[model samples]
Target: MPKLSVVMISMNEEKAVGSVIDSIQEVVPDAEILIVDSSTDKTAEIATEKGAKVIRQYPPCGYGRAMELALKSASGDVIVTMDCDATYPSKDIPKLVLLIDQGYDLVNTTRVLTKPKYMPLGNFIGNRVFALCTRIRHGIKTTDVHSGMRAYKRTLIHALKWNPDGPALPVELLIKSVRHGYKFIEIPIDYYERIGNTTLNKLSSTVWTFKRIFCKEYFD
Candidate 1:
């Protein structure tokens, strides 16, 4: 069996971090839990107690930077990235790992399978719009380019030269990996309302995702 590593980036999500950790443990018993947290609250404390390797990303760096830290610090054959807000389905993680074990290079998760009861209508529409733009501009067929939950093989991750320190880094990852000839797929999952206060700047994130969709590297 491959060593599975669950990586996440957190910021003041103390309310949901512990439950998120426990849920992952329940699904992937021996999975390595790694969190790059810049929480001002007890998120790191609770996560550490819950058996996750808590890497303190102090000064609250950008999401892309913290995510890059979590990904590069993981020590597993496969890496799964999710948010600490507990909106993603942890039960679906095993399916992602199974796909990796079945020879897929990357497994991206989608939350638009059903009409999301929890996600705001604007966000739902925004995600689909971004997905459509990506399909047209970059030729990637993923339906949820901004979904935080996804899986990546260690070799495919390290063999690439893309920087994870930009807006919508996942978009860049998908584009770069495709350029490198690696395979990827998107699997749908149930979505839920976040457990804590949302710190997301939807406007900025939206602009950045679109900017990344049309990045010059996509044509490289």
Candidate 2:
């Protein structure tokens, strides 16, 4: 079996991090768990107790930087990235791995199968608009451009040169993957309300995403 590494970036997600790790372990027992935590709470301690290799990401960092740190430290053949707030279901991991096994270069899990009431109306609209813009601009058809849950071969990381230092990382990844001609797949996955305060600044994030999209900096 190919080694699987589950990586998460956490920020003060003490309440949900442990449960997230446990759920992933239940689904992929032998999978390696890695956490890049910049939490000021007990998130790091809890993750360590749950058997996840915890790497402390210092302050003054963004989600992309944390993700990059975890990606660099991951040792598995396949790397699965998910949220630490329990909004993403680890049970869907097998589906992603299966796609990777079938030779897909990158697999994204979409929550568009069913709209959850907990999701903000602004987020729903923004995501759809961004997805449409991505398709029109780059010829990449993704239903959920901001979906956090995704799986990909570790080697795919080397084929892309662009890396954003903020929340725009996911969009950058998808854009670069398309530009590089990597096979991409999106599957619907279960989504839930997050357990803690969301750190996302919807306005700023959306603006940054559009800026990057228009500037075509993702090609850099």
Candidate 3:
């Protein structure tokens, strides 16, 4: 069996961490699950109890930083990234990793196939606009930009120089990966409502994040 490292980031996700971890273990029994958490609640305790290797992220470290920390700590050939909010289905993990075995460097969950009806309108619009910008500016076609669920070869993480410590990390990863010549593949996955406290401020965060990515892509 190919070794896999599942890197998950969470913040105050006490309510949903157990279910997410349990599902992950079911799908990837041999996979190493690492939870890089910045939670104020019982997230760490629950994750540890669920058999996940837990690491506490320091103050001011956002989702991107937490994910980067987890990636650095991972020791698998394939690295899987997802949320601890339980929005992403753990059952699709193996399918995502299977793309790596088939020679794809990176795989992103489109999640549009089963779009959540409760998703905010601005978020929906932002994702569509961002996907179009990625195609027009980066010359790569993608259906989702801010989707937290993804899988990729560990090597691509190094190749892309993806070390963003802010909310712009996802777009930075996509753009830099394209610039660095990594193959991209998108898989359909279900999009569900979040289970824990949300860290996103939807409108403001999306606008600010897109401004950063757009400016970096076009002017920098």
TM-score of each: 0.95, 0.96, 0.92
Tens-digit lDDT track for model 3 on 1-220? 5789999888888999999999999989889999998888898999898889998985648767887888888888999998888889898998988898998888888765434675677667778777888788767778787778888798887655654555757777766676677888888788778886688866665765676557764223
List per-prediction Cα lDDT, in the order shown: 0.86, 0.85, 0.80
lDDT rank, highest first? 1, 2, 3
lDDT per residue, candidate 2, 98-125, as tens digits? 9999999899877765566768777878
Which candidate has the top score in TM-score? 2
Model 2 error, position 171 (Å): 0.6
Cα displacement (Å) at residue 33, model 1 = 0.1
> With candidate 1 superimposed using the best TM-score fit, by how many Å does residue 104's alpha carbon deviate from the native?
0.7
* Cα RMSD (angstroms) for every candidate in the order listed: 1.3, 1.2, 2.0
lDDT tens digits by residue: candidate 1, 84-168: 9999999999899999999999999888755599989898888888888888876888888888899999998777776555557
Cα deviation at 213, candidate 2, in Å, is: 2.1
Candidate 1 runs further than 4 Å off: none
Deviation from native of the Cα of residue 124 in model 1, angstroms: 0.8
**Candidate 1 clashing pairs, residues 3+ apart or interchain:** none
TM-score of 3: 0.92
